[model samples]
Target chain A: MHLLAAELNPLGHVMDRNIIGGPDALLMGDPHGTPIVTMHMLTLLLATGLLLWIMNLAAKAITTGPSSEGNDRYLTRGRMAQLIEVITLYLRDTVVKPVLGEKTNKYLPYLLTLFFFVLMNNLLGLVPLLDLQHIVGAFLGDSHFAVIGGTATGNLAVTGGLALIAFLVIQVHGLRELGLAGWAHHLLGGAPWYLAPIMVPVELLGMFIKPAALAIRLFANMMAGHTLMATLALFGLMALSGMESWIAGLGISVIAGAFAVAITFLELFVAFLQAFIFMFLTAVFIGQLSPHDHEHEHAAETAHA
Target chain B: MHILAAEGNPVAVQLLPLVTTVVVFGIAFFILSKNVWPRITKGLDDRDNKIRDEIKAAEESREQARAAQAEYESSLKEARQEAAEMISKAKNDAKAAADDLRQRNEQELADLKQRAQRDIQTAKQQAVTELHSEATALAASIAGKILQREISVQDQQRLVEESLRELQPLK
Candidate 1:
């Protein structure tokens, strides 16, 4: 039981680790050494690569010209490509367009990339690749090797990076559209100069708070979901190893496995929902600083013309 | 209990993964913006334009058809009105011609009746003159036979005239 406890620590499955040579090495832990390449980094690259490949295929399928015989050019070709097109169009038309208005086209690429990347990472986390890698490492008598396994979005560093990018986009766009004076005026929270003393700091804090919330929300949701599934899986492992009666262990394993399956499905839904929320909130923040009335009037005039 | 304890490294924000995620995300955005998004957006725009044009064309054709139908209906109404006028004129002309023919025929019949009446009067007068001469000659012959001699011209004329005067009162 003691040996099993050491071998099957559930935290090890959910936590980030240095794949190459670092403090969190699976075989020999290096407490002082800084990680050059971690598991989450590898997962992030994989997700990016997968995103590029999938989007490339979708673009090709969507952009292909009509056949000589029929008007099939308008139709998105494959199921997967069609699904990607649907999601892209939905986010553009429904979520981003109404909020961003004319700027939707300019910013759509970044938002779309963010959504698909986060979603890919979230879904990759749900796969049992990490467990399979560990099982393979154990079989090979080398417990230190991990090629690609872990939730990149679940990590604080990764989610913080995404949120930081969102923050930069929002502020940069705000500055560009509002100029220097207009941007400073926005810090007043639409209040008179007398209220600037209070509103400035509050508005500044709100700016940082918004991105921080985004990072923490995505990170906590993903991490908690993975951790819950890991915990449920740990119960099954404990039932197998810690119990004296094999029948009781088997029964508990079944129950824990059932619960784990249910959580896995929930995590799948969370994966999509979290990605959507991140993109949607980023758009909303950007919309707040944009010249709403001017752009709307321009659009209305153009439509009239 | 073991799960709660930080057996391995505690979860914290690190530098490598953060930088890596930013780089990866930037690369994905750059590549996708250059290659994928523009094409997809263009496709959508093209499809929208095509649909709009098609709808406009359909509406135009509908309008043209409606105009043609109206024109055809109006011309049909004109032809029907023209035919009705012609029929009424033809009926009036036929009635006038028939009245003229009937008046001419009635006038010719009256003229024929008058002529026949004149001819009958002339024939009656001739027949009465001839009979009177024949009756005078027979009376003269009977008187001569009774006197056993031919009567003189003057005596016959006087005797005839006297007989005609007596017959006039009987006629």
Candidate 2:
């Protein structure tokens, strides 16, 4: 009949609900009138709190000596310092200041917060607990050895919401700067009168596409990295399962463990990279909404006149 | 079982993400738009400035303390040098005084010795002349006793002259 009746695979269990169809799929919300909450969403909120706590504590406990003392020392250096300083500087130099221009200092804080919120969310997704089995096992302790994991960004709906926010902000800023008529005209790609009809739909679609692309890129990367790691883990596990002797299983598991560890580190890099990519793209999109480079056009018009 | 399941129409597990996404997104938007993003940046900036100020103050204090210590050490070194020079000058002055006193004592001793030698020579000449005169006087008395006559002036002059020549050779 209509394709084979699907068998429920373990992948299906870890998969998030599909809202829209295919690559454009949005996250499925709750049927009981509750909104959908992805792992990434929870991760985002948690990361935001953690980031603020770390940053605030860092500021509060700041000391000038070669090393800080007591609680301040933990806040000021090592992992926390590495995390805070790297993300802050990245957002400031790459995202806020460049796109928003010299007048963007006021918005630097919001952008920085956003950058960290997204980055930490993405990074936390790579942590071991994101797996179903691991969480269950952690709760159960020695009761079970099973582990399950998933990437939050694998769901299109969550990324879609983020994109939508960026879209809304972009439009709001553009409208504020360009006014209503100017906003509409700007949407028309500022093409000649004869070209408006041809350009309008494309430009409008482009607006949605920009956000859609963001949602897809982040979702795909997070999903793919996790999927690859999971696949490799499964292969190692299968190899161990087939072994008759304990020694052989141990040998295979050791190798697999090493492989898993290597993949995990790579995924960690992917997490930060994806977040940076998202933030950078968002900045570029927002930058476009600012007043277009019309000074050159104005000068050209004046010369022609 | 199928009929009961259909009648219940319980939402399946696949739909869980959909429900979760909406609520989380709404909450995220509300929190982020309303409270989080607005104050978070300002809070961060204020904190950064505070840290910078603390660091600056600490550095300034350290610098001041270091300068004070250096100044104290330099003054101490200067004091030690001055003390050494004073000791050396006092020692040199004492040595010069002792040398001058020794030379003066030696000169006085030499002058006294020359004066003593001169006085002894004069005394010896006078003694010799007196003895010779006495001898001549005794001989004349004896002669007078023997021949009823005294010694002459020329004989007395010749005796005095002979005593003076012998005393000069002894001196």
Candidates in order have lDDT scores of 0.83, 0.59
**What's each prediction's TM-score?**
0.78, 0.54
Question: What lDDT tens digits, residue by residue, belong to model 1 across residues A1-305?
Answer: 54466546656666787776676555445778777778889888888888889888888888747566257777777999888878888999998998888999889988888899899889888888877876788889865346788788989899999999999999999899999998898888666899989989988997898898899999989989988888888887788878999999999999999999999999999999999999888887888888655455334323422
Tens digit of per-residue lDDT, candidate 1, span B55-161: 99999999999999999999999999999999999999899899988988898888899889999988877777777778878888899999998688888889999
Q: How well is candidate 2 docked (DockQ)?
A: 0.05
Docking class of 2: incorrect
Give each prediction's DockQ, rounded to 2 decimals: 0.42, 0.05
Worst-scoring 10-residue span by lDDT in model 1 chain A: A296-305
Off by over 4 Å in 1: A1-3, A24-33, A67-69, A143-145, A292-305, B1-10, B93-171
Candidate 1 chain B: 10-residue stretch with minimal lDDT: B2-11
As a TM-score, model 1 comes out at 0.78
Error of 1 at A240 (Å): 1.2
RMSD of each: 6.2, 10.9
